[model samples]
Structures are given as structure tokens and as C-alpha cells.
Target: MTAELDTPILDNHLHLDPDHGRGIDAVEDFARAGGTHLLVVNKPSWMLEDVGDDEAVFRAVFETTIDAVERASEVLPGRAWPVLGVHPALISKLTGRGYTPPEARDIMQAGLDVAAEYVADGPALALKSGRPHYDVGDPIWEASNDVMKHAFELGAETGSAVQLHTESGQDFTEVAEWAEERGLPAKRVVKHYSEGRLDGPTASVLADRDELEIAAEEAEPFLMETDFIDDPDRPGAVLGPKTVPRRVEWMREEGYDDAIRTAHVETPAAVYGIDLEATL
Candidate 1:
């Protein structure tokens, strides 16, 4: 079913790696369903075990995404933006498989360096760095925060927006403080897939229609995301990439036209500096 929305959507986060044959379908489907723009990211978690060589793993992840973005640019045009970075949970995932903290940090640095390259060029929209796995004991934060701080430093250096993935947005307060100390603009720091109280640039709660309304009322600068995982096997693991468009269609249906325009059009442009007018 093709969605014809009054306002086109810009999904803030989605993983569109190469092994993901489903990704092509997601791009086509999302566009067909009214997604005009996407921030395509690399999900290091999916390939962590398959590609045992840690350094090579990050390379493959970022390179595959850069290439995918290049290709999507042909079809989706300038709407396909790259989001390259190391997932904070990769360290813990590798450590569980017997890698030491230093070993993990070394591998993480390798991925982050690749991300820094694109960020410096300013083509890649943002660097995704955050605490994904939350069940670990308190001590794990020492190493995780170390990796996160480095990612944040890269953001500060490049002036690229840092889109964070957190346990439940609890770490963002501390992370935001960390970004401030390093001289990164608060307006360039974003919280990914979080609804908790965090002061920063953009925050996506993955809201439903009602929650979207509440979020709009609560914060003028808020955003929406699906966190789509483009995984072939799980089949809509978190939420489909087109979910945001569908939500926007409902917003239009419910006569929240003004709010829909703000979320799908205005906020994305103002927050990320992405000009969707070109896609039109």
C-alpha cells in the first residue's frame, strides 16, 4: 500500500548495511510510503560475531554504509545521508567473546577513525555513539564511557552532530555534560531512541500519534524516529522504516497538520541543517 502524505517524513535512524539485502527494499518501500529522507546508519551488532577480525569489522561496516549511501543517492537522491560510527556496545559484545578492554578500545578506535574521515568532510550527517546494552554491572560504564567520550571528542572536533543510542536515555544527561565540557554545541548533540529527560539538540521517542502530540507540546525542538533495523530474518525487529510516514499520515488524518509539518518538515531541517527542499 503506497502512502500519500501531505508532509514527507525524514526518519532519523535506520541501519542499511550491505549484508542487508532487505535494505534496498526498505529504501524503495519507505519512499513509496512517503519517506523523503533517511539517516542510514551501520549496525555493528549484526556483524560482530560473523566478522571475527575486530578492526576489519568496523571497516566493512562503515565502508558498506558509505557505498550504500552513494547508491541510494542515485535513487533517493540527496535524501540518503550516511551515519557512520562505532556502536558503544561493540566493546561489551567483543569482551564477552574474550577480548580485553584495551583490545576492545583499540578496535573501537579503528571504527571511530573511519567515521572521523567522513565527518570531517561533512557528507555523513552524524556520528552514532551511545551505550546500547544496559544490563551490565556498574563497572562496565568505565570502559563504555571511555569509548563514548572518544566518539564525542570526534564530534566536537568535526562539529558533527552526535546521535546517541542509550539504555533508556539515562546516560544522556552525563553524556551531554561531557559534550559541553569539550566545547561541542548542545544543538548538535542528539539523543537517539530516547524519551527520557535529556537536554540536547534533537530527541526521538518513536512516538505514536498521541505520544507525538504530547512530545510536540512538551518540546518545540523534538523529533521522531523508527530505529529501523533493516534485518532480513527478524522481519520488523524494532519498527519498519516507513512507520514514521504512517504515523505522519495519521497525524494528517487526525487534523494535526501543523504538528505533522513541524515534525516531518521543520524540525529535521532546523535541527540537522538538512535541506529537504532539494528532494522536492
Candidate 2:
């Protein structure tokens, strides 16, 4: 399919919160307007407001993730897919509230169990966690590595794609190291590109790596995203809506058609494990 067709353009990263003024319908409208495919992401804690105990909070978050996916699947059908995870800061906050790491892990497992019930066998799964700016040798970094390894294991076992949101250059290195250590399949790790001050440059660099890897290994797809958050007050917001087209042109200018196609279309389908071939 050509780029000009009203064919589906895959959206690699999207955050949806019904309570936050945008939900499935809003995302659908946006995608329909742009003629794109929408992959909706729902974080567990976004549903919780004043969760009291750590265990209770964990339960709430876990249920929210499952419920979000289940609801989205019903509401959006072929247009939407779900990604679930706990942000690192949220996990830390839960810990401060007396939730142990083991407890948190159990909660995540419970959510996965629920997810398996809803999605078909071998459904694509995405993880939403950030790498913090800290020393690689730090205990927290080690802990992050453990979490990513566990995520990879979960994806490999379920045949799900693992998507990561790394905050700093350090986070990228850490994820690469984690993937290398466990022999994580490149297809399982889909890195996101957000449109923020830090993320833009970092994403550009990552996209370059993705191109080089694709040239060398002809491996599984590496995902890219507009990752735009709309805010009337921000100058970058315009770029948010225009992200896909702009990036496509940018890639064309750079003589990176493969990267452009992957960023705007192909990688998204691969990341969500969608069968666009049949649909298009």
C-alpha cells in the first residue's frame, strides 16, 4: 500500500484515559481523521486516585490494566490494541506506601493472567517503563534491568512484543544491555519515540540505530511513534498532530525510505503484531 492511500497507518504509542478527556472514541476520531491505526496504551495507576494501601493500590492498578484492554478491545475492535504496565515512579511511590517489590510483581502477574483471558493466544504485549537518570551500577538501575528481563521473559513466553520507553541515554544503554544479557529477541523490544525536548534527540538517535540494525541483521521490526501529547499552550503540540507526515518527509529527505516506512507504518504493525497484510 502506498502512503497516500486511506489505508491504516499504525500508531505505535498512545496514552488513553477516559477520565482524562480522551478515550477510545477520541483516539478513533484522531486516527480516522489521519487515516491511521491506533495502538492505545493504558497505565494501571491512571485509574487510581486515592489508593490507600500498597496492596490495594496494586490490585486497583492491575485490574485497571486488564479492564482497559478488555474495554478497548470491545469498543474499538480492529482499530485498537492494549499495552499495560506500571511506570517506575508509580512503582516507587507504591513502595513508599509500603508495597514490597514482590507484592508489585505478583500484582503484575495477576494482571497478565487477566490479559491472557481476554486476548487470543500469542497476543502482542507492550511494557511501559522508563529508565531513570542514575548510575548504571546503582541498585535501582539493577532493579530496572531485572524488571526489563522479566518483561522480556513474559513476552517471549506469550509471543508478545515488548515496548519500552527509556527516559535518558543511560536508560537506552541499560535496555540494550538487558536485552543482550538474556538474548531477548529484537522483535520483542519495540522502542518508542516521544516528542519532548529530551525524547526528540534521543529518538532520532535510536531511529538511526534501528536503521543500522535493519541494514545489518534484517531482523524484526523496530517501532517508532509520534508520541505527541496535545496541549494548547505548547508550541510542540502542532508538531504532535503533524508528527507522522513530518517524520515521513524528514526520512525521505535523509534518503532513509526504509526507516520512514517503518516509523510511519510498518513498525507499528509489527509492534502490535497486527496482520496489516490481510487487512490492507
Candidate 3:
């Protein structure tokens, strides 16, 4: 049973790409399970998914995400939003048969341009960009880092908070510094799947009850996530859509209502620059 909290916890991050995965009723399941809002990122990691090799075509996925989330929101009003951009892990996939560094970089920049426009002009609440995966060796890391820096510039220019997805345990201070150097405030960042502080707030995925407690103690006003892949084969891969509410129940059992209220409610509201508090 989903915990009946007066204030529904908002999942800071999750991957519910329209075509990559997730059912039509994904938003409803999250809502019924006590999730009030989610930042669904479209991990457009490959061309095999019918995206083709064109940069414009790849960037169109962000627009499609807006449409998809809108459709979901019809079933659960204002419950779903998008966080779209180039994920570094998807670089190789985006490259396709004619993989070239310069070509891929230009294509990614195009995607970031689209992301910035949506973030400022469309319903996209934020942007997500990161190295394709952890330390893909120095050569790969340097190139990806340069591409990600452009993303940071977009985040800074558009005043959109960037949700980072680098490898776990990597010092994100440099990531934050990159944004800050580009004129974006470091605080306007959310480190996804973080274990400790880097320079901004962090969010957790699949942490157990005890782990969650330790995380909260380590960082005040952080966030929680399920990273719910919504894939049938790996159903509830990290945690299900209902994960946050279940964790909230655990916190309550341990008498940690304050932590729940902050991470699940107030903090998200402030970070996303929208109202997500106590809609219950």
C-alpha cells in the first residue's frame, strides 16, 4: 500500500521516455502511489530506436517528450513534466554509422539549443546533460566534458536548473565550477544519484531505509528518486513509481517527518521554481 502522506513526495528524477518505455498510465500509477510530480528525462541514447542520424531529428525527441508528458498530464493534471537534452552516455548511439567527433558535437549542440528554447519557452521545467557514463577514459571524458560544458552554458543562460547524471562518486565540484564559470550559479544544480555533497543538492535512487537516513544526515534538503525505468523486463529496475511513498512511510516509522517534508516537498518546490507542496 502507498503511504498516505499529507504532502505527496515529488520524485526528482526518472526515465519515462515516451517510446523507449513506460505505459500510458505511468503518471497515474505514480500519483496513486503518492508521487505528486516527476522530472521525466528522455534518454535518447541511440539511433536504433528510430531517431535516425540527423541532428534535427534527434533534437525533435525533446519536443516529442513535451507532447508525451502533456498527454500523460491529461490523466493526471500537472503531475508530469520534462527534462530533455543530450545524455553523454548516448553519444556513441547518436553518432551512428558515420560517427565523427565534430559531427556529433555539432549535433549535440543543436540538441542543447532546442533544450534551451523549450526550457525558456516551452513546458520543459529544466535540462539534463551529463557524461555518457563514468570515466569513459580521458580522451572520451575530455570530449564529453566539452560537450557537457555547452549544456552548462545553456542552463546558465536559460536560468534552468541542470540535473546532472555523471558516474557515482565522481567529484562534481568541477561540474558545478563549470556552470559557475559559465555564469550559472552552482546552487542551480542537482546531482543525480549522489552519495555526498559536491556543490549542489543531490538526489538518491534505490537507497534503502537505512541508506536514506544516512543520506539525509549527510546532506540537508536533498531529493529522492526511483529512477523508475518503466521497462517490463526489468520491472521496477531501480525502484518502482511507488518507491517514494514507500520510503516516506519508512521515514515516518523512524519519526523523520521533517526529512520527508523537506526532501519530498519544500526542497523540490524551490528547486523546480514551481508549486509542489502539500497538494493533498
Candidate 4:
């Protein structure tokens, strides 16, 4: 249904778990649904078999994402880029293992440094960082913010975009402030799993009809994503990989061609500094 439209359908955040899930077949599913591009982000370090104490543990996670992106790109119409970093939830894991809040934050920052190296060395296009979505005490929360700030610094140094996964319901103006203060443009910071609000950093609105309508009504360019975890056990726990392209097909049928172009073409290119049209 979506193939008739030449517009790109880029999923802003996706995870491909080759070891325990559909792996590249998931990418094929997205392709069949008319998805053109993806940002295959790294899963959390704890998802790996070994959640080691050292910051180097994240390297394996990033490498797995890189491999997944390489495989998915083969099936995508546009491209699949890697987005690597230590998941903000890692602080909880570290603290559970007897590390203090500040220590965990330092470890997360170091892990992001590794991710930044991958971006600079050409395996990844962006960095992912955010505080835990659930509530926590003041110290842990503050520490998580520091870790996110370090990610912003890395983004500034490496010239890569940053994707965030914070708790929902409020404007992310504070996050935007942090990004700008670290020398990374607020526009380059994407709020993944967003609800189509423009009162924050760049939005990667979830591919829901109501949310897409809100974003389209705003007439502001924003990216779309499914946040598909690709977990076989929890099938479609977030949204399915096909969600974005299917939503795009719906948008086109509804005569939202301008929104389609803005989201799938212009906004992604602007945020990631990639030429989606040229890549195609």
C-alpha cells in the first residue's frame, strides 16, 4: 500500500535482537510494510549475557547493533544506521551491584565515551541516553542527568545526534537546555517515544494515529518511530516495526503528503545530518 508513495519511511528507534529474536527477518518485515530506513539502536548492557563492571562491556552491545544495522540495511530502501550508548536504566543495574549513584553515573559516561568513539570511527550515526522512565530518588536522578549531559558532550564532540528515552508527560525544555549548553544543538536531540509535542527537543513521535494527527496539526516537522524492541518473548511490546510505514501509508491516503515529506525526509536528514534522498 505504501510502495506507491516515494516518500521515505524512517523508524527513528528500533532494536534487533539476533540472539533471541527474529533478527534480520524483522527488518524484512519492516521492508514488506514499506519502511525505508531505521536507526537500529543498541539494547541495554544488561540484555547481554555478561553485564560486566567495566565500561568496555558496552562495546559488545554496540558491536551487536552495528552487525544488526549492516544486516538490516540490506533490506531497507533507504538505510539503517547504528545508535549506540549505555541505556540510562543501567544505573539501576549498577547500583544493584553495589555501586553508588555517582559511581554508576561515571560508568555510564565512560560507556558513552565508547559509543562516541564508535560514532566518530564510523559505525554509528548517533548516541542514545536518558534517565530512567520510572521514579527514583534524588541522587540517582541527579546522577542520571549527569550521564545524559555527558552524552550531549559526546554528541557535540563527535558531531552526532543524540536520542533520548526519558519519562513522559512534560516538556523537555530542560533537556534541550542541557544539549545547547554542551554545544550540541537542541534540534539534534531527539525525544524518542514522544507524543507529538513540539515544546521540547526534536520529537520522534510514536507512530499512533492520534499522535501523528497532533504532530501534523502542529505543522512542525518531526520524525516517527516504533521503538520496537524485537523481543520474541514480548512480541510487539512497544510497537511493531511496520508501525511507521503503515502509519505513513495511512497519512498518504489521508492527504498528509506534506507531513509525510517533512517527517520521513526533511526532519531525519536535518537531525542526523544524512542525505536520505541521496542515499536512496
lDDT of each: 0.71, 0.47, 0.70, 0.88
TM-score of model 1 (CA atoms) = 0.88
lDDT of 2 by residue, 42-67 (tens): 54463454432344554455455445
Q: What's model 2's TM-score? A: 0.65
What is the Cα-based lDDT of residue 157 in candidate 4? Answer: 97
Write candidate 4's Cα lDDT for 1-280 as tens digits.
Answer: 6554487778899899999887998899899888888999888777764554575578788888898899889878878999998888889988998999999998888888888999999979999999999999999999999999999999999999999989996488988999999999999999988997766689999999999998998888699999999888899869998788899888888888899989988998789988777777
lDDT (10s digit) by residue, model 1, range 61-167: 67778778777666663368888887777777778878887777767766787788887876687888776557775556666777777887888788777887776
Best by TM-score: 4
TM-score of each: 0.88, 0.65, 0.88, 0.97
Candidate 3 Cα misplacement greater than 4 A, ranges: 18-20, 45-48, 51-53, 94-96, 196-201, 204-207, 278-280
Q: Least lDDT summed over 10 consecutive residues: which range in candidate 1?
A: 45-54
Kindly indicate the candidate among 2 and 3 with the higher TM-score.
Answer: 3
**Candidate 3: worst 10 consecutive residues by lDDT?**
45-54
Residue ranges of candidate 2 with Cα displaced over 4 Å: 1-3, 44-78, 100-125, 130-137, 170-174, 180-183, 194-221, 228-242, 249-257, 269-272
Say which candidate scores most in lDDT. Answer: 4
